[model samples]
Target chain A: MKLLKLIFKNSLRHKLRSSLTIIGIAIAIIAFGLLRTVVTVWNSGVDAASANRLITRQAVSFIFPLPASYRAKIASVPGVKEIGAANWFGGVYKDKSNFFAHMAVDDNYFVVYPEFIVPKDEMEEYKKNRNACIIGSQTAKQYNIKLGDQVVLEGDIYPGRWEFNVKGIYTPRDQNTDATQMLFHYEYLNETMLQQSPGRANSVGWYIVQIEDPNNSASVSKQIDALFMNSTAETKTETEKAFTQGFISASGAIITSMNFMSFAIIGIIMLVLANTMIMAARERTREYAVFKTLGFSAKHLTGLILGESLLISFLGGGVGLFLLYPLIEGFERAMPKGFFPYFYVEPITIILAVTATLLVGVLSSVFPIHRALNTKIVDGFRHVG
Target chain B: MADIIQVNNLSKSYWRNSLEIPVLSELSLNVNEGEFLALMGPSGSGKTTLLNIIAGIDRPTNGSVSVSGTDISKLNESALAKWRSSNVGFVFQFYNLIPVLTAFENVELPLLLTKLNKSERKKHVETALNIVGLGDRIYHYPKQLSGGQEQRVAIARAIVTDPLLLVADEPTGDLDKNSADEILTLMERLNKEFNKTIVMVTHDPHAASRASSLLHLDKGVLSTNGQSH
Candidate 1:
């Protein structure tokens, strides 16, 4: 305990240097935490996917639509319970920068996804009107939309200005599930498309199938795909989680880059910490010699050096984590609805940051402590400083 | 009196780029218990080397150094360090007190190795500092103290563990004339009143005069024929 006190005091010998090093370490930790959070948020889509749900889309590409007739065939598959379909509207509000997810979903979409909670009256109101729609709570908040407001969507794909009444605002039952999407009846889009372009009618972007047993998802998915074998629009059926994972893998390079960036920040912090420790050890050569002359063992001196290094690292890590908590809260609040809605720093991420900081502290001190202990007492005494 | 330090044909050498530079030859000496022995020599005459060898801080290239009946020359580096901690004290020329620590804390350093608790360590440190007339300045840092006061704090630190021998390498070399005299006087008092065996290396004649006997080293040869004043 006495040795620890001495080590603490010694670390403060060069006040400016220690403070600067700690600040540098804290900044690196902040960068590391932010990057890890980005990777976590990106993978959250897959993490929050329901086990009992399967998504069927065009085998060629998601951009190509599947004939809505495939929905009945998917529901007839042995393990399937219920089915719903949606079509991507690709609409922008006011400008492209004010973009949010807009989709045309089947009237029975809530039956397949029971987690999107809407008030009973609002759900009834939505079913009563053809041009009525439900927006996520996050989307509603973003545009200051209320239960009786009119929302105008300038369609990018259907290429028409569509107007709808905001009938309700839905929230997610699970916090990890996104609540930033705008959902409307697919029949309205189908009828409008039939009048504007006849060929695009009776088509959907994907089919969501809720299965009776999650364990039979694989076989059921295979059975559903076989129904559309060699058709004009072949279908690919997979669990909802796998579908989300497929989207993640489609942008594999970006996620991989984020992972690399997280590790790179740790490396940079290690270098900075190592440099600081080495310089401190170099300046205390004579002091170490004094300790040796007073009968301090080489091991004791090494412990002192390591203790000082660990102290600096732990302090920096704590401060960095403290700063990160509020930053993550602010970031989540500022993010657009439906875009990375569940972005948060997980407990595992905090554990990893602490572990990395400790490893950096121990590893960085090894070389300097070894060098300090190896200096002969006689020679160390000769060093005036 | 029984001998506290017995040196038999001690030698020390350094290698500079594969060229051997001999610091001390096979010089032999003995210091009795409760005696003040001063080593006087010119620069590069190996006075400090011999002093270090006697204090068990350095191993001799040849010959054995027995302090308090233990052959320190044959001991391993770790064992020598332990032996030095409990049996020897060091006072360097520039005081060598940790600048960040108070005088009391500096004196308490050697006692940290012992199993004594904090209060016990504080008691021992206070007694040692009071003996050196720095009890009132226990909380003062090294930079806050004058040269003489710093050297007194160093003395307190050296004796806090109550070692068998106190080894000083020019303890007053960095002090002014009055401060040097005061440090020499303190050493004299420690030797006479506390019966502490002391081995000091210095070039100052006045510093050497305070010892019971004087030994001169010239080119690694020791001549104990110089009479003490």
Candidate 2:
């Protein structure tokens, strides 16, 4: 107990240096936490993807479209239980900067994605009218859009000024479910495109196929892709997770760099802590020599040094995490809505943050412990530091 | 009385880029229990080095030092540390108290190696502090105490474990004359009343005068100016 008191006192002996080091460690941990959260959010769609769902898109690229006729053919596959189609209606709502995912979906779309829980009456109302649409709760809250409100969008890809009536607002079934998109009927879009541009009529960006058994997804994907083999819009079918992952992997370098940077923060924290521990050990060389003469064993000396280091690290980590929760909340609020949908710290991020600090604590103490333990009694006394 | 310390043919040296710099030559000494012996020498006379060897804080290049019939020089690092903890205590010139600890905590340091509980350790610490005339100042940090008071706290720390011998290297080297006199008087009482075996190294003849016997060293060897009172 007395020894522990000494360790605590020794760590705070230089208040300014210790405080600065702790602050440095804390800031580094915060940076690490934020970056890891971002990486988690980037891959969140893939993690939330349904295992029983398969996506069939143009093999050449997602930008290319597949015939809407492919849907009936895909639904006939033995394992296919249901099928839905969506066309990416890239459009500007109010302003280009006020961005959100907008898609035109077939009537059976909600049946495949059960995580989007829309009111049955609202969904029926949306399906009854040709110009009715459903916006997610996040989008409704972001834009103040309500039922029976009018939503006007200038289409960039389809190239037209379009308008629709908001018929319903869909909320997420769970936290991981995306509530940042707007969904409308593909029939309205197809009827317009059929007259405006015959080449783009009755086509969809992707087809979502629901299978009877999730385990058969590989075979089901192969069979769907084989049906469209050597055709103009060759289909590449895969599990919903892989399809979502394919989009995430398009920014693979950025996520990879972010992953690298998060660990780099851990490395920076280690360096800061190691520097502090080393300086503290150096300053106490004579004191350690006195301890040696007082008959302190190597174990005792090690305890003193390591105890002080770990105490400092744990303190920093605690403060960092304490500040992180509110900081993440404010960060999410400050970000443009739907910019990073579901931007919350994952449990794995917290675990890694804690484990990183612990590792830094032990690693930072290594050189200092070795130095203190190896110093001869006479030499330690002679050390000016 | 039994000889509490035995030093036989002790030597110490170090190397400076392969050039051996000898600090002490083969020397022999012995002191009985309860004897207060002062080692006085000029600068570079190796009095401190000799004191360090007898205290078992430093190893001799050759020969052995035995305390209570145990050859301390033969012990390994940890064994030597264990032997020193129970057998030897050291008082430094600078009072080397851990500045972060209170006077009471500083004195309790050596006894931490013992199996004494907190209250037992506290009791022992208070007694040692009272013996050094600092009982009322146990809660004071080294920075809050006078130079003489700090040295007293150091003496308390040294004796707290009740070691077999108390070795001091220039104990009054950093004190004013009045503080030095008080320290010498306390040592006198500890030797006369407590029957402690003490070996002190100093350059001051005045400090050496308080010892029952005196020896002078020159060039790492004891000179013939040694005498007993």
Candidate 3:
């Protein structure tokens, strides 16, 4: 039999031990993979953010409003290509449980986010009616919404029942695109505010600014914020990536714990596999002595020990990865819609997982290899049994 | 017969907390080609230590051992290992067969070092096992075999490479009388018919009587009074 065959047979020598170690490693890998996927989904927005797009929000916080008149000032900025006024509507559809991002946006908002694919006819229908709204494909699917259908919202922030027609449905341009937001006319909300809370009228939450060149975004953002410097509504401007990153920080602890736990799982994997290997090596001391007597080199013993470790590691890792895809799918389905807009197993996660498993395999074999190579044949024979 | 194995002023010692504990001291010895020589001694007599030195599995603190022509004591660890694979066969006291490997696989271990094809190695393994009267039990694991059968499989492994010398340390020490006689008879036939040289260390006089020549070790040195050739 080949040396590989011997390695394979030796790994199976203690059937229960090998199997248990393999299962433990597999489960740890799955947990690590799941945590990694959560972390990836957590940053999906930042990954999809456009470099040329920038957000100008009140320096105090995103919750505060900017005067609607600032949209014209932002549009006049030297490098600004397109600018739109928008506000966080926070309008609940039916009950508080039916949660989704509802935002009020002017016509140019859609232009700034071209990744939202809206049809020509639907765009015309949406522009024709001030009460018309565009819901993302996922949002449409969740509410079973259709074009020309009236969608009513109980305004939690504005304290009024509002009605709007679904004039268009927009789909995501790519996997990282979030298709879970509902966009309606900012003017419609502004008009209701003017008639009701006059003080909150003619104000937008933020300005969505697109620039001529992404390289000029930093200068343009500085120029936009400088326009309102020392004013009651001082603005903080940054690229969409930074905006999304700031948004992710809202749930920072969860992601931080997941990052910690992912690495913690790797440590655990190394310890479990090392324990199994050390025990096996101890039990096979005399056998290694016999091998030396038969003229097997230290390199051969290393191959046997390292090969068995890698075999078990890869077996566990392979099974864990195979189980991860379905587990993530189930996890995604079990969560409320739009909870994590783009849940995907990124390629880097697989690369890191495979790399970690191989590293752990090599690491676990260190002590065993040293023991095998250092033990004199005579002393090993003395330790028989 | 030419002296196929030679030893000159060999010494082996272990260091315990800066104290010297000698196992073999200034020992000199020789064995002719095709000779089945047995070494008999009491516990702590250093017979096994001497056997290990001759087998290239351990090193001496002083002096040299030459088998056939090469001074094995002068070879580096890796080179000595390679030389042993090509020139020396070993049978251990406990019949140290790999418990995970089948008899066929165990016999194939030494041959794995050779540049032989799978079929060629298989043929050599079968021939060796047949010579040891274990041809039909090639697929059995070491744990599946009785004490005598395991020793036979280890012997099969030892001879499969057709090495120049065989060194067995208490090869039949763990076997019953009938099994011990069978193993000794097999070793004798290998020496007499095939001319395979052997140096065995044993405690039992019955086992030593089966050897064509005999020696005794006392106080870490060879005893000339019990020496016979």
DockQ (C-alpha based) per candidate is 0.79, 0.72, 0.82
Candidate 2 lDDT, A122-171, residue by residue in tens: 98899899988899898899889999999999998989888999998999
| DockQ value of candidate 3 | 0.82
Clashing pairs in 3: none
State which candidate has the highest TM-score. 3
- Predicted candidate 1 versus true structure: per-residue lDDT over A1-385, tens digit per residue: 7788888897888889889888888888888888889898898888888999999999999899999887777878898999999999998887776767899999778888888999999999999999999998877887799999999999889898999999999998887777888899999999998999999999999999999999999999999999989999998999999899988897789989988998898898898989999988888889898988887888898899999999999888888898988888787767664467667788878999999999989998999889888999888878765
Which candidate's lDDT is highest? 3
Tell me how far the alpha carbon of residue A80 in candidate 1 is from the true structure, in angstroms, after superposition. 3.2
List residue ranges in candidate 1 displaced over 4 A: A114-132, A144-152, A159-168, A194-198, A211-219, A329-338, B17-19, B226-229
Instruction: List lDDT for all candidates, in order.
Output: 0.89, 0.90, 0.91
Reference-based lDDT, residue B2, model 3: 99
Q: Which stretches of candidate 3 lie over 4 Å from their true place?
A: A142-150, A195-198, B224-229
Better of 2 and 3 by DockQ: 3
Q: How far off is residue A339 in model 1, in Å?
A: 3.7
User: Model 2: how far is A180 from its true place, Å?
Assistant: 1.4
Q: Score residue A315 of candidate 1 by CA lDDT.
A: 83
Q: Which 10-residue span in candidate 2 chain A carries the lowest summed lDDT?
A: A335-344
- Show how many residue pairs clash in every candidate, following the order shown: 0, 0, 0
